[model samples]
Target: MNEKIKNFADSISPLIFLDFLFESRKNLTRLIIYFVISLGLIITVFFMQLSYSDSSRAGVINAFFIIICTSSALIGGTYSAASITSEKEKKTLTLLRMSGISGVQIIIGKIVSGFIYMLALSLPYLVLTLLLTLFGDFNFFRLAGGLFMWAGFTFFYLAAGVLISVLFKKNASANSFFYFSMFTLHFLISLLDEWFYRPLYDYSSYKFFTNLSPIDVWVNFSSSHLYGSTYYGNDGISSLFNGTVPDYAVITLLYILFSIILTLFAANIFEKYLRWRED
Candidate 1:
């Protein structure tokens, strides 16, 4: 067992990690500059808007939450969607593949990069969270719940992005495919829940099956947020390890697990692609 673990670890390429780290570091500087500018803007807006404000805590929270979540989706989604395909476009992916690094290693590297990128983005942005406190009394759980759910969801999407990029040779094709497919699927899942899953939950273990869809996992928390979905009833890092496993946390874990499964599947396809290119 120990040998197997070590082998698995050894299979991962250090080069991918190094490249990802370098790319993340490059972005870090830009993010810091943006943070500084945004902070100034926020303070200016805050004082200027204060005179005209009649918003409650909940109202402000929801508005800010929507803005942050939307921005994260757009930026994170674009970055991830381009990650693998950009390498492919530059011919670097071909070199990496021919260099004897396994498909699994490549996918692992991309996922780790995504996670590291999330950290690189999120850590400095904590100051924004502090800035958010100015709007009203901040609900820690809401922030926690949003962050946890987004992290898991982002991981899933990042995997999907890499998979799409692996399947396509061009950056434009990969990005287009990722965006349209995810949007369509998100809608389809919402419809299914509305038409079938919601009424059947009391009588079936459908939530489990539904939760299997990352779309469903998202809807479970996001849909209910309109009515103040603040607690970590079954989600997030803190809720995952203490005592009973939260159902949502379980779903999040399933996402990570499925990500691995998807990565393996993508690797298989990637290896086949490499073989085809050689032939």
Candidate 2:
């Protein structure tokens, strides 16, 4: 038990994680620029559509989802992408391997720390959303659903980033591939609608294909009105009161499960890319 505890402790040494966070803080300018641009764009969009014959509240909510999802995905691509590649690039993995550190330990540390960073990035947006709810009839329940959806997206991207980090030698290549693959995952399915799947929207296989994108999960959540939605996201966030499962809830569960699978897969093959040099 003592040995197990010690291994876990060493895996997530506070000093290492703190330094990692410090480096992130050093990139404050880029973070701020991204925040400002995304926030400005969404706010502008909300006000612009408010004057039109549209659902202002729902529009803003959807915009917030887009911003939050994009930011969280970028965080995963950067932080998780570097988790293993940095150690490998600096030749520190050899020392960790020699020091009796296991692949599982490394992954746990990376994911835990990356999750913290992801939360930090999302904090401002969360606060803003809360404040918005105060003045409007904005459903707090919906906000909760959106936040849950973002968490699922965060986990999925983090897992994908780690797997990419393991496969690529350089962080640059890993980040690029992470972004490309994720975009492909989320966007490519929709293209089928323009050509083939649009007419078959009600088909089981069609529903299955649409469900593959996290964006679809968010869309399902955004469509809910005052009353809670049903199992397949055919209702609102208040569905818990109605004893029905919301669509996002099911998708979030799937995301967590998929992330676990990806993490395990990465850990299983982690050692192939690490080697020790003796003097």
State which candidate has the highest TM-score: 2
Best by lDDT: 2
Candidate 2 differs from the real structure by a C-alpha RMSD in angstroms, to one decimal, of 5.4
Candidate 1 residue-pair clash tally: 0
Predicted candidate 2 versus true structure: per-residue lDDT over 38-70, tens digit per residue = 588547654564454335655565567667888
Residue 253 error, candidate 1, Å = 4.2
Per-model TM values vs. the true structure = 0.65, 0.74
User: Cα miss at 223, model 2 (Å)?
Assistant: 1.4
Lowest summed lDDT window (length 10), candidate 2: 230-239
Q: Give me the displacement of residue 239 in model 2, in angstroms.
A: 14
